[model samples]
Target: MDDTPVRVLIVDDQTLMRQGLRKLLEIEPGVTVSGAAASGQEALALLATTTVDVALVDAKMPGMDGVALIRRLAAEHPSVACVILTTFDDDEYIFGGLAAGARGFLLKDTPPDELVTTLRRAAAGETVLGSPAAERVVARLRTDPHGTGLEALSAREREVGDLIAQGAHNREIARRLFITEGTVKNHVTALLRKLGMRDRTQLALFLAKHRDQR
Candidate 1:
C-alpha cells in the first residue's frame, strides 16, 4: 500500500458542511483536503484539474446530486474513489450512490475517527459502509431474495458472488479462493453481465439476497 497521504475533495452544497469536513479530514495524519466544492458541477470543474484519491460527496444537492455525481465520476474520473455523506440514511441514496460506483456510504454524524478511517480504507480500494447503511443493505437483501438472478451463475461464479456479498474486493477474493485477481475480475464481469447489474454494489446485493439458498 502507498504510504503517501490520501488526497480528498469535499462536495456539499452547504458551505459549513464542506468546511467542517475539510477541517476534520485535514487534521488526520494520512489525509489531505485537496479542494472543496459546493455542488457537483464545481466538483467536476475541480476534478478536471486536480487529482484526488477520494471524493467525499453529499447525497443531496440542488443539481447533479451525489448519486449522479458518482456516476459521472465513474465515467470521467475513474481513478478517484467516491464516498457518499448524508444526514439521512435513505435507502434510495445509499443504493443509488453505491450502484453509481461510490466506494463508501457514511452519515454526517459518523465519528471523526471512523470517518477518517473509512476514507483511508476507500482510498486503499476497500468498500466502507456506516453501520446503519450496512444494516439497510442487509435488510434490502432479506426483503427480496428471489430475484437475485443467482440461478444463472455457475458454481465458481456463485463462490465469487458469495465473497462479493460479504464485501470482499477482487484482490481479497482472489487470495481467499486461491485464484488470480484477473480471474476474480473475470468472474465479476460474468456475474455483472449475467445478472444485468451495473457494478459490484448490485452484485453484492444480489448475492446477499440469495445467500440462504447457497
Candidate 2:
C-alpha cells in the first residue's frame, strides 16, 4: 500500500508449502512475508497480533478450511484481504471462496511472476481471481434464467458497469465520468447489489462477456 513492501501472511497446513510460498513472494518486488501459519486457528490468532495486509489461504486443511477462514477473517479483520490458494479445480471451491469474501483465488501452481502480480493487484483493491477459472466461474453465472440480469441497473449504474468491463478502477472511473470517488463507490456497490454479483471483478466479467450485443 506504500513505498514499503506489502505485508503478506501465508496460511496453509503444510510447512513446506508455506516456506515455498514465502520464498516465492520474497522474490517479488515490494512484497514481504510477514508471517506464516499451518492452520486457520493459528492464522486467525496471528492476525490478532500482527499487521497483515493480505492473506494467502489454503483451500484444504484440517480444522477450518480456506473458505470458512475467508468468511471468518473477513468478519473479524476487515482490514485484511483474503485470497484463496489451492490446487482445487472444483466449482464448489471457486464459488464458495468468492461467496465467502475471498478477493482472489490462485491455483497452487501459479507461476511466481503471476502470483506476485495477483498479490499486487489484490493489494490495489482489485479482485485477481486466477484466469481461466475466474472466467469459467463468471460464465456459469451468465446462464441465469433471467438473462444477464445486469439490466436491473439504473442508467448510471450501467455506465459504472460498462467502464468496469473496460478495466477502469473506481478512481479512474470517477475521473472519467467527472464524479467523486465516493459516488463511484456507491454506484459500484449499488450495481453489484442489483445484479446479484459478489464483487467488481464479476461485474467486469459480465460486461465483457456481453459486449458483443452492444
Candidate 3:
C-alpha cells in the first residue's frame, strides 16, 4: 500500500455534501481532503493550484458536468484520478463518467467507510465502482457483447484485461502476475489499443460480458 496519505478534492454543487465528505475523509487515517469545489470550473481552478490524488466529483453540476471535468482532467492532469459521487445511478451518467477517464463511480449515499476506501483505491490507481454502478456496467455489457472485439487481444493482453475487469490496479496486477508495474502498464496500453477501447472502464465492461467464457 502507498505510505503517503491520499489527497482528495471534493467537487459537488451542494455545500452540505462537500462539507460532509470533507469531514468524513479528514477523519480517515490514510486520506485527507485537500479542497472542495462547488462546480466543475471551480474544481478545475483548484486543480490548477493544488495537486490532489483523487477528485470526488458529482455527476450533475450547473456548468461543466462531472463527465466533462473528468475528460478535461484526463487530458490536462493525467495523474489525478477522478471518481464520480452522485445521487443518480443512470446508465448514461455512469458510462459517460467512465468513458471520460473516471477511475471510480460511487453514489452520494455510500457509507462513509466505503467512500473513504473507494477514494483510497482510486488514489492507488484502481478502477473502483459502487455496487449499483458495477451492476449497471455488467448489464450494459450483457446487452452489447458482440461489438467489443475481445478476440483481438493477445493471450498476455487477455490476462491483463481480466485483472483490469476485476478492478485490479497496475501495482496489484503486477504483483499478482509477477511482473513490473511498467510492464503491466505496457500491456494495458497495448490491449486498450488492440481493443480500441477508450479506457479501463470500457475494457472491464467488455470483459464482464464475456467473463463466463473466460
Tens-place lDDT per residue, model 3, 1-214, is: 5579999999999988888888888889998788999998898899999989999999889878778788889989999999999999876567767867899999888998898889888988999999998987787687656534454457887888889889999999999999999999889866654454567887778777787655
lDDT of 2 by residue, 78-112 (tens): 78888888998565566667766788888888888
TM-score of each: 0.68, 0.66, 0.68
Candidate 3, clashing residue pairs?
A: none
Please list all clashing residue pairs in model 1, or write none if there are none: none
Q: Of models 1 and 2, which has the larger TM-score?
A: 1
**Candidate 1 local lDDT, residue 180:** 100
Candidate 1: C-alpha lDDT: 0.85
The candidate maximizing lDDT is 1
On the 0 to 100 scale, the lDDT of residue 52 in model 2 is 87
Model 1 — TM-score against the truth? 0.68
Candidate 3's C-alpha runs over 4 A off are 146-214
Q: Residue 46 of candidate 3: its Cα lDDT?
A: 92
Ranking by TM-score: 1, 3, 2
